[model samples]
Target chain A: MNLGSLLDFTYLSFIDACKHSLYPYLPKRRSIQSDRVHLEAAVSWLMKSIDKVDGNGSSKAYRILNGWMPPYPETSGYIIETLLNLQDHYGDGKFFQAASKIGDWEISIQLEHGGFVGREIGVLSRPVIFNTGMVLLGLNALFDRTREKRYLDAGIRAGQFLVECLDENGCFVRNLHDHLIHTYNVRAAWALIQLGLLSGSRDFIEAGRKNVEWSLGQQLENGYFLHNHFRKGQKALTHSIGYVMRGILEAYLLLGEKRYLDCLKKTADKFVAIYGIRRRLVSELDENWKEVSSHLCLTGYAQIALNLLKLFKITKEERYLNTALHLIDDVKLQQPLNRRSEYFGGIKGSFPVYGRYAPLQFPNWAAKFFIDALLLKIEVMRDYENSLIDKLSLGRQ
Target chain B: MQELAKHHEVFAVFGKKGIWDHLDTYLRRRNEIDVHRRHTLAPLLPASHNAHAFPGPVNTLRFLRRLGIPCYKVSHLNGAASVDLLKRLKPDYGIAAVDHMLLPAVIDCFPTLLNAHYGNLPQVKGRDATEWSILLHDHLNVCLHEIVERMDAGRIYLKENIAVDKGDDFEILRAKCQDAAKSLYLRFFERPEECKNLYESNEDGKNYYLMNWELKALAQKKVERR
Candidate 1:
């Protein structure tokens, strides 16, 4: 944003460029730890990210220039699900308390119209469609756990706000990113579907389905989604692509319709084929699915890993699970473990920490998605273990 | 295999000798094919043609040639040459003796590609399945199935769960599994059409990867203790 920041970014970019050029020539130094270890470290990072905020919720990220950005309502809202999930996983009361506090903070910040403000707190006061949907995710999750009327009411309001944003064609015509429709908002559709299931509202479900169908129109035959970039006319990063895939997969989970899975397969199968050959996904891909950037979007990897694991669960396809494992293992390797550092346990937005996406920062969403992927990985592993153990028991003499 | 040749036009297509095959051959020459090679009597050891370990493609090829069956070797089953050869062969079905992953190119060459797995279908899959079956299920199984693109995932033709006796060790269990697998394969070949789609698709199965040394060791202990 500033000249100094630009110079700092330029210098880091130069260093990273050099590393990228020499990466293949250098001996591979990847060290992968156990999934449980990575999960613990990531949850700790999310807890620390939450702690950095004043009252509740989580900071947007720990920036290189600035210490910690302002608390982000959008990500912090969804982080409620992560914290509660951690509580269930570890049997710790602290995560539930933390999640509850975040939920309350989100409800307090809700606009009179029920939509959450765009960007981090204090940056803008205008309510946004995407942010409102994300907040609904946390609120609905909190309501599911505590069954509190307040959380339920907040969730319903947020869900209603999202429903209102949708036009007759199911596209969110208001508060779009850069005044352009983004395919990633299908995630909002996912949140709407969740809320619909929670509240048993047919309107929300229909609206959610309509939006998914609308998003499907944006998908090219090559599986690339149009208008998926942060800014119009730019190549879509794996992050937004992950968002699109995740939303469709979630819709399939709730609807139990083959069409949703078919929609996802258009994109997911292409990704699986490309990933099988390259072993890594480039940060950005053009409309033709060509690699346009060399940097690794760690958040995208985590998000896609979570989506792929879910796909595997549904299809029982070995490629999906294998690809998901590779993606998460790569993310696990990128995670920092220096306890004393502010960025400890946090996953960087980009592998080099200076890549175009979220340059020089570790975003909270990255850690959130990483934790989610790890949790899913654990479940998949448990299913595998249980299945094997069940089969083995038959051999008992 | 010799009996199959008498009934059907049986031939063997071996994957080009991998590093393990070369190593096995080298070890066999020095009389060090097994860890207990020096102590155990030669009569106690399984024959070279047995599925105890990598008997090397050369041994198998020699055996097939001796049986007067044609033999072909290829660097990769998915390679252009291999596919070209398969297209010419135009076999009704092809049997896979090794645990190699056949690509769609090779798979499309035949109506069905049969494989024998050392674990139960829609249950145990992937590497080290025999050890996993013993350690987790306390059972041993051998499945004969059609090989699709994905490893160990196909429509099973037969699944025989071999009883794991208290006195059985890894070697004894492996022997039983190999025997069962061989018998299943022959039975399928006897009535190929009847064996087709005998069992349902293994859609519920998960692809288990190679077990870690720690788990493998634990499995070994379990097998020996039993």
Candidate 2:
């Protein structure tokens, strides 16, 4: 380690040690031994968390052990997409209303540069590529759902900023607010792909493709990608790692590339090797792909499970389906079925409640991805069964 | 390893010795490890001569068994009988796993040996490498190298530099190194010849040993300091 990294690691470790001392009574993790899937309640907890935002336009996030945080524009923007999808899937207009409010609040915070500020509501934050691209995804979804001109226009500005940040290698090489380049931008790339197609911008589409193409270079043979840095280099939380994996899978969904799917399968299979028919998934891994931490990243488990289900749908692989089913079963069991607190349905950053990722907090993105995975499970299962039904009907005819 | 197994016929050779860093968790049963230790944690644990390998290897063998691959447990991997078994199997290649160390006889038993080393050679060689990398503050690497006479001093097939980041402890760094090694090994097998030109000879490179517990705690404290 250089002097710079040495100091950085030392500082992070000190703060973490302090936190453990400070919160001795904090639960190590939320248990998921039960078999109940709390889809509605999880959504309710997220909304309740969002509604708990005090003296702000929206609740930034909910700490599993604490209360609500100041409104976070980045998450609030993306949560819009989740809420809209929930509305469409369940035919509940209430979701639409809540999403529109968040959408409007997201639009209200757009910077003069078309990017939204980072962190919670009170700081004087600058534009970040990942955050801006996330907001763009929400805006694009809002435009698609409601055909709102304001959402479309804000999304256009965000897309333009993203386009400006692109380098020749297809990476958003600028405006990281640090020296690190993240593979999680694969999710942002998924958003940009959506925006490009939605707005009919070829440049945006090409940028998304190039970003993914470059990301492929980061994949290690053990079925992992590098550049998973999130605030301390070299280490990555499975949650963000899942984000990149899902993002690449999403990219394959949009682009129809065999390489993308192949990569996704390879990575997913590695997880199956670890989970081995849905065993416990710890939050962190080292350079060698061994379990680094014992606590699970609930959101990552759900996201990866969702990807497995998606793959199973296409390939009809029982291992993929079986692993995904068991994985979801685990998450559902972990969901707070009867907790009186606001965390009643929220998925945590780390299982056992206090591992690093969110450190006893519930970010909106976790709930959002959980919702996506659950809803996706229902959709893919229905589609698969329907395909069988269609085949039967065709054969009868 | 499964990826490699999927492409070619694979067999496993087990060393009799079991290295459990935790004394409290030692196996009283001899069914697991190829060798049976007479020592027992007794009373708090149990006194059983039969021990099986750790859950990872056992579970893996179970999975592989379902796929129709047979595993042979032996006292010495490089022993004459084991060598005869390898010669009889006439396997094209062998993938040495994380826990087992191949003796010169065992390694040379096969025509070619593909071993995954947790540390980059020439700079880092030998056991407890994750600790050494952090102690020396060198960039951590996971590598696939062709086995030569000297340990970790082999023809480097491929390697990837991994970050030993903030808040990482022994387990975390070890896991990352293991993950990287698994990945690099698979990639090396993807096109075995692609790594032919990447060799570097480090006949006199320094080798590392396991750090003492006191040194480890200090280094861990340094890495985890906020």
Candidate with the greatest lDDT versus the true structure? 1
Clashing pairs for predicted structure model 1, backbone only: A391-B137, A392-B136, A392-B137, A392-B138, A393-B137, A395-B138, A395-B139
lDDT per residue (tens digit) for residues A210-311 in model 1: 999999999888888988898866889999999899888989888887988988987887877677546579899998788998888999999998998899
List all candidate RMSDs to the true structure.
7.8, 17.2
**How good is the docking of model 1, by CAPRI class?**
incorrect
Error of 2 at A196 (Å): 1.2
Q: DockQ of all candidates, in order?
A: 0.05, 0.02
Interface RMSD, per-candidate values to 1 decimal: 10.3, 23.5
Q: How well is candidate 2 docked (DockQ)?
A: 0.02
- CA displacement after TM-score superposition, residue B212 of candidate 2 (Å): 43
The residue-level lDDT of candidate 2 at A219 comes to 88
Report the lDDT tens digits of candidate 1 across residue range B1-226: 7668888987777766588665544443232112343223334445762444323224567788998999888876678998998899899988877644678888889898888788766787776577667655656778888888888888888889887766555555666676687788788887888778457678886556544333455566666555
